[model samples]
Target: MTDTDVLVVGGGPVGLGAAVEARRAGLEVVVVEPRAGTIDKACGEGLMPGALRLLQGWDVDPPGRPIAGIRYCSGETAVSHRFVGPAGRGVRRTALHEALRRRAAELGVVTVTGRVDDVEVLTSRGTVRAAGVEARWLLACDGLHSTVRRRLGLDVDPDRPAAADARRGTDDRRRYGLRHHVGVAPWTDLVEVHWTPTAEVYVTPVADDVVGIAVLGPRGTDLDAAVAASPALARRVADAPVVSTTRGAGPLRQRSHRRAAGPVRLVGDASGYVDALTGEGLRVGWAQARAAVATLDDPEAYERAWRAATRDYRVLTAGLVRWATSPARPLVVPVARRAPRVFAGVVERLAR
Candidate 1:
């Protein structure tokens, strides 16, 4: 069996980032992923300023359009808040994946094209084994609905009555996301979030000539219908050619009882995810990756760090998701419009 100091499951952006962090810490890392090429996902594709800074620190800068701020719109009401620090970037998922993959490669991280069906944690020996590879620590970055988490008995059932109450009813109604790209010039520098009664459409400028549209709502949301609900958004992309096949991800809410079990630590979405309502997935995942690698030797410390790192995201995103799915959903835009400073404050907090 191959040997390494750390083994990362899944080769998505967060998995690659975890591998990079381990390599930076002078540890040999191996990443196992079933997918063979650059990985893409159904995401909003807007990296907040904090996330951009983290990638820049790793010298992995992917090309994309600059995102100046965020705009919330519903009917005729609209409100926006520009980031005060470095501008965020709206990058294609594949582009971001390639950049992180390159960085991990440069650091001598090995990638295996396979899946880890079984993981064995040797607590006494301080090692973990999975898929013919042995490592001192195993990082489960496999993402929401992670098999690693489930196998380790860390998965929490959000549908349970107790769990539902703990989540503030965010899981009462499951939501999913669908993303696609269109070959149309972006009309705005800001990421525009158009609110609908049943769903929300995110418009992000990934390239000068391409815009990404993502819809989040109950399962089986029609991407076309969601965009059509927003007249202004519908008109902008009415004649544009669709550039990418639709990618989907779902049951947006996932939970893990804890971040660590024996020698394995769940990083990124594998740990737990509330929702993507605030567009904080990448930023929060990156943070968890860093924390996971930093506290590899101390599972308890890693658990604390993971909780601290995700607290804000868990709180804000869950609260927003609850509000968005509630009966007062239509008031979202108007409330933001009326309370401009409050909206700006929230945006600024998230941007950081």
Candidate 2:
């Protein structure tokens, strides 16, 4: 018999989500990861209402502050939108991971605490000898720069001529994200996104007494400098004490020519990423995880499902990122404030 029906690589939210969902689908699942306890990553920490609903369906509720809406601020201009339905939550990454880990254990998903390297794909199975685990199928949620994608020859070939934009210097620019937690009471249930000339600072309350600040900007952008650029956010956290060391996620972009190759499948950031401007990473990723396992019987179905699941995010995020980086970047907040109805509609649509 195969060691497991589905072996999930990476134990972050996406990996864990896949493992749990696979087990729920009545498959024997095993997760291979190097980390043991709750895993944390640099993230905005805001779960959109739709994301919360998705997690709830899996019965994986983690403690956190309730988020009612979203707010955009730049200089003296500001725009806000409140969800028409249930509010979202802002759970810490560690908390979210631990909750899912516990649920996975309860559901009998085994965990092998070891890293997977040099994956070998056999005719009917995928094997990671370093971890000595083999499964009929593999779901690589290994993250932004997936090792599996590279080992499988799915990554963009560096030797290949760069894309047109890269040749034109546009692709040379890359964005990264940094996050830290501070001890303080949140001022609003709405997630406040402070847009600056060079960065976007996201203020998300993860607990009754703590808030997380995530900054996204060009490479080498300083977190402190970014925070200081946002007046409203600076004032709010001026007196708050830092509670967590800073963490980061890079390039904010990844690529995968295809979703599946042989027995290995890429999910979450491993599959590909656009940008986090809309704060819908978790929602899109969770959807992909579910779709990944649900379509195991027909791997090609995953490509269609993945595209459908990420359609909104890909379109909206790409459009917004382009606008944010263009010469009209300075007009973002002002235009949002000028067109309240339109801005609210976009925010609500993305929040879903």
Candidate 3:
């Protein structure tokens, strides 16, 4: 089989990031993804300032509208924060994926379409037989419920059955996300997060005449119902035509026992995920992508970097999710209204 220095499984944004970074590092890279063309997902569609910078650094510029800040609203009470630095972009997920894919291609990263199977990690190198080739190092960016992570046995406790853990982790409150695009001129240059008792709906302007609305809530949560619950959001989209079909994803959480095992390294949602409440997944995923490639020779260092890169996302998301589901859920808007500075600080910090 043909060999390469780095083999990336999954060709979403983070996977493309890893491939691009590896190619820039003067290493031969090959990416195996089952899908072709632009990829789309149920996401907020708002790239934070930091994430935009990372994309710019990679020389992958996707077309979209600029978002200057974030606004949190519930009924009449509202809190907002304007990022002090460069504004972020609200590009469609397909646009972002295509941009990365093009950049990787320009950088000489080979793309092969197929599922990765039979991963074998040896003392000298890790090899995966896929796409009619083999590679020395494997970067698993396959996403939450990564096949590579499972094949490498990095997803569960050795003594406990995975089936049991998955069953035990099941809860009635498991969250999910749904997104749809509507044709309407955005009223604000801010990413608006409209919160309700049971869900949070994010409105991001990805084009001058198009805005994407993504609803995040527990299982069985209805997107239309969630939008109806928010008077402001419902009013805004009442007359707008939906430009895209509704898309969905989640239980919204995935856990990995480790970041690296032998010659394999996990990045992006494949690594581990808390929740999407804070809109920090792409930013954190970008950071992990850089770290995974940079520390390929030292898995320990990659683990440390992974922890450092995700520290804020994990802590803040968990705290907010806990509060969102707690008895005080109804108090969120009031708290933000009363503690404007506190709310703004948190928003601005994560907006990067």
Candidate 4:
């Protein structure tokens, strides 16, 4: 077997970032992913200021439209917040992936294209083995519904009573996301979140002339229906050409019993995910990647670091998601409108 210091499963942004970090630490790394090229996913496409800083540190910068801040709208009530430190960016998923991939390649991170079906090989030996390579540590950065998380028995079944009790209603409301790009000039610098009764439609400017629209709600939530419900949103995109096909991802909530199992450590969504409502996935995942590599020798330390890294995202996102799904959902925008400072504080916190 080919020996290496680390093996990263999945080649998405998080996985690639982990590989880059490991290599920078003087560790030989190999990444195994089934996908051949830069991957794309359904996401809000906004990179918080913090996340952009992290990418820049790694010398991986993807070009995109500047995002001043966030705006929330519900009927006639609207509230906006400008980031205090730096502006964020709305980059297409593929562009971000390509940037990360290029950075990894620059670091001499070897990527093998194949699915890892045998989880035993990952945790059986002191040196994890898979995809014809052996490594001292395995980091699973796979996205939600990760096979690595499941096969290693790190996944927590939200349906189980014990899990439900521990997670406190994580499985109660399952939400999914759908995204598509439209060929229209961005009208606003701030990311607009149009809230409807059943779903929230996020409009992000990803390019000079391309805007990405994403819908988040129940499983059957229709993108067109959500847009149509918002007269303001509909008017903006009604005549715009659809630039990309609809992409989707779902049942966004995922939980892990623990982040580490033997030499295998779960990173990014594979470790656990609260919800994407806060638009903090990339930031949180990038932080987890750094933590995972830094604490490779001590799984417990990594666990602590992981928790610390994701604490804000978990608490704030979980609370917001709970409120968004509850009967008080209608009050969200109004509350923000009334409490502008609170809204700005929350937005700045997330942006940071």
Candidate 5:
């Protein structure tokens, strides 16, 4: 009588992740996405060590891409650290979408390539009905602007949605996402963070002979502007050649706040969001998927797990964003550069 046991709305990283885990847990999952091509959401694509291990729980091994550790450079100091077990993996957004979509197929999650016109939460036992498809369970996994979050009134407000919950600041200081691929090799074994007066650029060695840069800057500044401002990164890529296009995720007032309402649940950027500063967005999504599947037996329990896995990261990420954006380069640069042990310690704790 229904299309599937669980209807996952959206085909982004989180949605695919939810679908994958749901099917693996024996739930008949259906993913509804409106887009025609690969759903490449705006992101700085890097899976953290915690996320990579979580993938193994779902029988997903990260594609064989090498990620050394972390290299951080701010105003006065620069530090690089070698990675521990399964440091992490970096894949482009488009490539990750495609690979996950393919994996979803292997997992037997039904893919519906269309948008939902409407949804009705049937009152009987508090079931979720979307576009006449009755799902024993429902997942928002849609994204920050999740329609499910809105429909269920689980978001902060009727008109505001998730706009009022996250930390905000003066518009004069803005943050934008910028990504560019370079045609160079082995910039080093560590992921690099180059900080200028106005912005911070993260360098990821994702592919065989290429490195990806995701820089966050002010509203008027972009990837091109970041490149111009940072002679260090520019010279490193001078011979490497620029490959990926510049991209940005417009700063929004709120992130998703609803993890579940009745049988409905949210994941990744859908339930809430992570600032690009953490480079842990994908891991957050994957971790939520694991939690969601475990909680599927009872959506309420799932929400608990989701919140537990994310609460610290969300708070930690908020503080990190402030630090990354702060003008205290002298104090920040030295810590980020010379003493990666502190950062590594923080990361190890987060992974656990």
Candidate 6:
């Protein structure tokens, strides 16, 4: 028996973004999350330059972390690329979520802990209603397998459905990895991306006291084998002590339709999420969150814009995956190494 202008169904970063946006629009907001503890999600903790810009627009000051560039290495060759015009910051997922949660509270958005029992879209009243909450608008920032989405009868596209599917009756393997926090990093200013024939290693300095590192790929893909693939880099990590363990990653596909249901907007993974291999989910999510907020007066307009952003990312990331795992990789490497601009342009064109 609580009410607000908009009720958000998740307490993650994107959910917080929606709640904050509603408050800015002069609307009362309530967020319902099943869990009350600090949010910990399976994510690689780095913000793209675009996401950083959006945060600044929201008056959000991202925690300062030094990131000069991203380093990618293969068999015997390594190519380093910097974020061209704008710099990117790396913040741990936990820190980022906590920051957003606190910010939402300060903005006067009510966040309550409860799994949504259901969402009853009231077409006649022109408002979406949900468990313990009612609002003119209801946003589903509630991750994949969203209760809001399910109540509306929207189905996810079957990409890595087994691994990424949020259905109740599925048994898919979730990838797990080790992430250790360290005050020191090999390159303090670079978000290093190292590669093996079988796996990819990503290192982002998210805070002064911690560097976020994740080793992820196919489920059966062995980390030891991947590390051995990169002899020099593997030795560096192998010698270092392990500190933390983060779990679950796989190919999360983009759901087809932009709008989840009538008057119920979906943002972030709830709208659509691409495979994490490209490392652009949070960036894309933030961009859509802001755009969705902007078109609050017209949710359909926001849905169209959000759909385009997702299509752009999916096309770009899919192409990269193909090339990275292609037979012509030998040729692709030299070209990308010598002319990053060309590579960047193509990917940016598809993704942006």
Candidates in order have lDDT scores of: 0.90, 0.87, 0.87, 0.90, 0.71, 0.68
154 in model 1: Cα distance from truth in Å?
0.5
Q: Which stretches of candidate 4 lie over 4 Å from their true place?
A: 121-125, 160-171
TM-score of 1: 0.97
Ranked by lDDT, the better of candidates 1 and 2 is 1
Q: Per-residue lDDT tens digits of candidate 3, residues 1-352?
A: 3389898999999999999999999999989999887889899989999999999999988999999998888998788878888899999999999999899999999998888765766655345554566777789999877888888777753233346335755332367899999999999999998989899999999998999999999888898899999998899999999899899988777788899987789999999887889898989998998998899889899999999999989988987887887778888878987888898789778877
Better of 2 and 6 by TM-score: 2
- List where candidate 6 sits over 4 angstroms from the true fold: 157-186, 222-225, 329-332, 344-352
Worst 10 residues of 3 by lDDT: 156-165
Q: Write the per-residue lDDT of candidate 6 for residues 176-271, one digit (tens) a residue.
A: 343444444544567666666645777788766566667666567654565667776666666555445645544454463556466688888777
User: Candidate 3, 73: how far from true, in Å?
Assistant: 1.0
Q: Model 1, stretches more than 4 Å misplaced?
A: 161-173
State residue 65's C-alpha deviation in candidate 1, in Å. Answer: 0.2
Q: Which stretches of candidate 2 lie over 4 Å from their true place?
A: 124-130, 157-168
lDDT per residue for candidate 1 within 1-352, as digits (tens), equals 3399899999999999999988998999999999999988899999999999999988899999999999999977899999988899999999999999999999999999998888888767778999889888899999888989988889987555445555665444378999999999999999999998899999999999999999999987999999999998999999999999999997878888888887799988888888888999988898999998888878899988988898888888878887887889999999999999999999998999
Looking at model 6, the pairs that clash are 68-189
> How close is every model to the real structure, measured as TM-score?
0.97, 0.96, 0.93, 0.96, 0.88, 0.85
At residue 64, give the lDDT of candidate 3. Answer: 97
**Ranking under lDDT, best-scoring first?**
1, 4, 2, 3, 5, 6
Tell me the tens digit of each residue's lDDT in model 4 across 1-352: 4488898999999999999999999999999999999788899999999999999999999999999999999887899999988899999999999999999999999999999876655444577776667778899988898888998788887455445434765444478999999999999999999999989999999999999999999889999999998998999898999989899997888889999878889999888887888899989999999999899999899999999999999999988988898788999999999999999999999988
Instruction: Give the Cα error of residue 176 in candidate 1, in Å.
Output: 0.4
Winning candidate number (lDDT): 1
lDDT of 5 by residue, 123-158 (tens): 675677885578878877777667777776666532
Clashes of 2: 0
Report model 3's TM-score to 2 decimal places: 0.93
Indicate the residue-level lDDT of 252 in model 3.
72
Sliding window of 10 residues with minimal summed lDDT for model 6: 170-179
CA shift at 36, candidate 5, in angstroms?
A: 2.8
